[model samples]
Target: MTWNYAYSQDLWPAMISVASTIFLGFYSWNRRNVPGAKAFAIGCLFAMLWAIGTSLEIAAMDFSTKIYWMKFHALWQIPTVTALSCFFIEYAGLGRFLTRRNLVLLSIPALLVFSLMVTNNYHQLIWTSFELEEYVVAKYGIGTWVSIGYANLLGLVNLFALLRLAIRSSRSRWPVAIMLFGQISGRFMYVIDSLYNHIFSPGESVLVVIGLSCSLYAFALFHFRVLDPILLARTIVIEQMSDGMLVLDMQGHIVDINPAATEIFNRPASSLCGRAIVEMMPSDSGIEVQPGKIELTKFEINLGLGDAARYYSLGLTHLLDKSGEALGYLLLLHNTTEQRRSHELLLDKQRVVATLQERERLARELHDSIGQVLGYISMQAQTAQNWAVAGNTGKTVPILSRLSEVAQEAHADVRESIFSLRAGMESEWSFLHALRKYLDHYHTSFDIDTELLLPEELSEDILNPDVGIQVMRVIQEALTNARKHGGAHKVKVVFVEEDGYVIISISDDGIGFNQADLILEVGKHFGLTFMRERMTQIGGSVIIESQPGSGTTVVLDVPIGT
Candidate 1:
């Protein structure tokens, strides 16, 4: 004989379960790449299977058919707790502990239980007897209690894991808390139904509770952005990056800091968060600004903590909303202590090498100029002595006068070399001060009138030492060229800031050579080439304005970034 099944109102709980299953399954599918999503999907599949089997059992009218459906439903029920445990572990960021070996071990009990229920006819271990009362099927056996006990144990484990995670992370606590409460309530209802007959059929109240809980979960997932916190925390690329990151609110307070940031600040994230950023900044950092309208700022800062000091290049950008309103600031700190130190050390080595090379060049110039003049004077003295010994006084007078003139020329050359060497060795003056001293000396020595036009608001500290050196060298070269080559009698210098650059202009009231002559005979005019190279090295430019019978004007434009 064949049996036909009829629909039952009791299947409402199963319908709800199926709907929840579809929603959760789709949720898991959408978040397939997300951590723990596979485990969540597995749990949803098992839950859906449980709902289908339970629906079949409730719809059956005969005792044997109900028993058959009940046994089939046990297949879904037996693994539900295990799958939930796996999901909970992964969801809590404790997936490292759930190895393949551990999973296989966990599956053993579920498999054994499933097998016992399927072969209940041969062994009677799952259900020794079955009875139908008011269209409800109830089973009694040692296996029934054992399955409940095992499932409860697994549920307890999942609850504990989620509870631990909820306690640890403030961002994801609510969702985990809700899941824990739901599992406890559903298990309590299951135990109550098993102990005494209730208005709701066996497993119906539990399914209803679970289904409601899943709905709540889906709501939390879509509505609250519940997954983002854990996702960011576990993403290996961001977590492992070396650059420090900080997310700040518009209140100038520290909101969130990454691990690298924590290390950079030399404080734990717990203590650093919620504190005002001004308190953490170095005294010289100059980061003072209103909270909401953070300016686009980029600079290097040095933070000193006892014996440990580090340099960091700080960059601040406005975190804007979709409508372009200011949300907060994203601060990126790139640690540059090692790189800066290496660069400084390299500069130091270069300076030493340059000093040695300069000394060699000076030695060669001395030998070629003053030394040659001195040797010529010695030869003239010997010739004058021979002329005097021969009593040729008439020839001696002109020869002695020539010797005196050569001696005077050598003396001037020696004085000039000493002045040049002294100027090269003086390394500790501000750019403006050094240029002033140089111009004063030039005016006093050459009797040239000098005028200086300087911006009073210019801060000396803003100029980089390296840039100052290059600028000063260019000024010196231009002044020397004006006095010697162009015979400049009056000079003017002006300093101004324009378009993110510092411009210094030096003009002379001297006869100037043709610009074409300077370009064509570049080898003879090494000073202009040196000035151009020095300006270029510091991301600056040089402009020369000159023509024959017109005074030359040299303008140096240097970017302020350096």
Candidate 2:
């Protein structure tokens, strides 16, 4: 059957579609350079191009004949698909700087399917021949069973491309689902019409139906701005990337530096850029920047903060022009001081732990062997003294003399003290130092009032280590608990040793809940449970008291005398 050669109501839609699409294409292109107006203009242009191209194909062909329209439709359809694909990527929030890598990757299945169509219809290319209908062109090429197969294959590939964009956009919170939706519905109707006409009876007019569908889709696309969200999201994500990126001109001036690079150096991009990186980096950092090549340089640049001693990994490279000559430098600054510090800290902790373990072993051996022997010797000396005082003069003389000799040996062992294991006067100061050191917040984010009440002493003791560690842990937990649940502002902390007990009070003035159940279920919070376990090992207890409005107080008490 042949479609009638007339500009009917059905072709009217195609004409309007083409006109609007071309108008959008030009307007969008013109506004491309406008900041903030780019995505909208681009989307309009995409729709416009598809409309204009499809319209021109229909205008040249007889709409009522399947064979004629089919012959030329592929040429028009390809550009529309290309435009849609580009629109999908941009509309789905890949940003204007979308990598060529991803684009090539997505084109694979489309290329393969197009290849299959060409291979199957060897003499006819992807589309074999055309059948014309009223206001539409339908292709009838493949043999009956293979016709279904080819159509299915085409459908799958088109759907795949669409779904890929939809999923990527979904992940980024950009609602480009409409693009996927429009592609599937518009293409599916056209495919079904071709298939139905080829093997079965002539059914619904696809172009007329799809033209109506496209009108609806275009309406939805332009009105709801269903593909509009991706552009805004691109703005947000680019503002948060790890590596430093700077876009510059032909001169050796700076364009921009991300937040990470700003922190790596002392100054913001506003202050540092356009002023040259030479004045910014440290003199001793062994960095020398010149034009025309990429350079990997290490630097000890002082970021003038509380942590002024830190260093960074400086990556300086020339921004190349199309011909590979240096236009400007793209400097990437990464801080490596933390990595170095962390490595050193691990080694130091390992050594200290090993030394402590060795001392523990020696202390155990001394207490078991020499201490027991000394106690036995003292017992024997007392026995001999008793006999000497009982008036067996001649018999007791040898015994009394031997007792004195044995007593002197016992006294020598007593003089050989293991004070290293205990908290000496120096250990108190060391405890304070250690506690203060642990409390140090490096790149920390928390809001809480911390106070330290320590004595005037530098000492070390086994009981002190045990008590001090448990007390500090309890205070840490209490502070965390207050911040998490109490909703309080002021927190008071106190530490003291009296009556052979080390006592600590961590109180917070916040909305204290009657967490009677939570206290009962303290074993649930692993941190809290571990804390209680730590205190228990040191012969201590952690007590929590709270009332709804008043606030909360946690007291950790440890017995020093065992």
* Best-fitting candidate, scored by lDDT: 1
- Evaluate model 2: give its TM-score: 0.33
Give Cα-based local distance difference scores for all models. Answer: 0.76, 0.53
Give all TM-scores, in the order shown.
Answer: 0.78, 0.33
Tell me the TM-score of model 1. Answer: 0.78
**Candidate 2: residue 450 Cα off by (Å):** 28
Mind giving the per-residue lDDT tens digits that candidate 1 earns over 409-505? Answer: 6665465446544554555756666667777876786688899997888877546776777677778778877876788889999989978898999
Off by over 4 Å in 1: 1-4, 96-99, 121-125, 135-149, 156-170, 195-200, 225-241, 266-268, 280-298, 304-308, 318-328, 349-353, 385-428, 446-448, 452-468, 477-562
What is the clash count of model 1? 0
Per model, how many backbone clashes are there? 0, 33
Q: What range of 10 consecutive residues in model 2 has the weakest lDDT sum?
A: 416-425
496: Cα error in model 1, Å: 8.7
